[model samples]
Target: MFNKIVLENGLRIVTENIPYVKSVSIGIWIEIGSRFENQSNNGISHFIEHMLFKGTENRTAKQIAESIDSVGGQLNAFTSKEFTCFYAKVLDEHLPLAVDVLADMIFNSKFNEEDIIKEKNVVFEEINMYEDSPEDLVHDLICQTMFDGHPLAYPILGSSSILEKINKKNVLDYYKQYYTPNNTVISIAGNFDTDKTIELIYKYFSNWIPVKKEKDEQCPPMFYRRIMGKTKNTEQLHLCLGMKGVPQGTNEMYHLMVLNNIFGGSMSSRLFQKIREERGLAYSIYSYPSSYKDTGMFTIYVGLNPNYVSTVLQLITEEIDKIKNGGMTSDEIYKSKEQLKGNYILGLESTSSRMSSMGKSELLHGKIYRPKEILEMIDSVQREDVENIAKEVLDFNRLNISFVGDINNNQIESNFKKIIG
Candidate 1:
């Protein structure tokens, strides 16, 4: 179970007490990321995430890392399309240490001018590294093609040209605008006294004044039929087919998950079994749904030899059509529901997963459901629900196709036109 308390400053502290565990996981989730950024300062959120660990008022870069390492604790952070999280996992006895260290990084980071200059090179190399990996780069291209002219299409890593001009002042200014107590959630889970943990967090974060700033209101990204092909010297063709999907917290999302699982989410899924196991058309192929605050995307990725691209796309298209037209069997629906429930339960067994779940639920939805509630929701999904969602979200005509490999543009255009038309 989880409990939450909203502080006077508008910060929320949510915790789950797991008596059986000896470790606790804590995270600070900020409800802003690359999507909130405009074109000029696109990657600053990710950049600031890195700068937070460089040095604080009292701890040097080395000391901050050593403080956690010396105690056998894990400390890390990640930036996503709509949010950023700085988290740490440590022994329950060291909960205070974990909280203090994270607080320091969040509140006292220097964002030094010299460090900004050096980290820009590091981020640039990181961008180049992704460009060299076609499989990874293709996913970004898919989003670019789907959301042609929106901020959502901007790469989370920003662009080399933009980063080159960003200075310390720019990063600090952006950080101040978004990183407020009201805009953040502190989540902790594991064996600990709830009152004590809350007190510790309050001690570290209470002094900060909450700010009132207007959040950027973004219109949902419109989807269109687009085919983007980038010719590169690669061994296999990396292709992604995607369409616009439901937003977070929508009722249809549950049906969409079940639909995706039966279609391509697991090894027993239609795409994996038919494409990889049965016909040996591709070594990697699967489908996933990405839901954000206002909108989402449903995408399928495949990496196969250039000779197999045509066959693979055809098979994938056939599988989707089959699911949409005929719907999945009762057995498939039962198994998928069971698999989803079991995985959701097993995932919460870890302190880290529980902490993350609590944080995201509160931040994204403004409410968190108990495991029983979630399982019930999953069990309530019927075959018709899945079929209805599939029909609404899956359309061959209104889809985007992105490919990265040694494939000519004319070749892609011809093949896609034949199938989509």
Candidate 2:
């Protein structure tokens, strides 16, 4: 069972005690993300994530890495448009130490000027690296186009022009505005004493004051989403399509997950069985759903020869029409439910996954739902529910598509015609 504790200072701690496991995964989830920024401060959240490792007031970046390495533990962090997390997986013997290190990086980083300059270039190079990978590029396009002009449209790895202008003061200012006790959740999983663990967190974080900041400036609703990005060549064509979907905490959210699983999400899904196994159109094809606090999207991605790009899009639309008109089978419904259960159960093996689960659920829903509860929720979804979601969501007229590859602009226009036709 997992236990939760809300601190006096407003930091929430979530923990699970698995006695059989000898390791613990701890994560600090800050609610703020790239969406909290304007164009001037874009990418600062990610840049600050990098800076956290460069050193704390008491530890150098190398010492931090070496300390974790010396103990055979792993320390890492990531930033997304919706949240940023710093996590550590350490042996149970070092749980207290891990908590100290993580809390320090989050609450007391010095943001050194020298390290800031070097990490800036590193982020720029990271952006270059993404330009070389079509899969990442096209998905970025999907997100940017799907939520055009909203903060969601901006890439997590902001452009070099903005990263170049990013500075230590700006990063620290962003951190101050958002990384507060009220805005953070601490998730810890695996063998540990609940009381002692909470004590460790309270001991470290108690002195930190809660911060209140101005609300993020709102943007208008997005429509007719499209990403037209230009870059150097790649072999295969990468294409992504998305339609606006439901937000979290709704009945429609459950149905959308089931709908995506049947259409193109699974290995047995219609898109996979038809496009890859049957037609030999691509090596990989799948769909997934992503939900933020207020909004969500259902997206499909495929890679194929630049020549057959049009055919792939047509097949995808055909499958969408099939699901929208006819609905899913008992067999697809059962298989997808089983797949969902299997993935959730398998995730329990890792402390990191559990930590993330605990944090995000609490952050988004103000509650923690166990794995068993989630599987049951998935299992309870019916074929009728899946079909209803498809009818409401899969509108060819409202679809958004993004392409990133070495192809003629005419092909892009042809894609639009085929979808609309």
Best by TM-score: 1
Candidate 2 lDDT tens digits, 60-89: 888888878889999999998888999999
Tell me the deviation in Å of residue 230 in model 1: 2.1
- Evaluate all candidate structures by whole-model CA lDDT and list the values in order: 0.90, 0.84
TM-score of each: 0.98, 0.96
Identify the runs in model 1 with alpha carbons over 4 angstroms from their true place: none
Per-residue lDDT of candidate 1, residues 235-330 (tens digit): 999999999889988778888999989999999999999999999888899999999888999999999998887788788888888888975799
RMSD of each candidate relative to the true structure: 1.0, 1.6
Alpha-carbon error at 241 in model 2, in Å? Answer: 1.0
- Highest lDDT against the true fold, candidate: 1
Runs in model 2 deviating more than 4 A are 217-220, 225-227
> What is the number of residue pairs that collide in model 2?
0
lDDT of 2 at 51: 89
lDDT over C-alpha atoms for residue 72 of model 2: 96
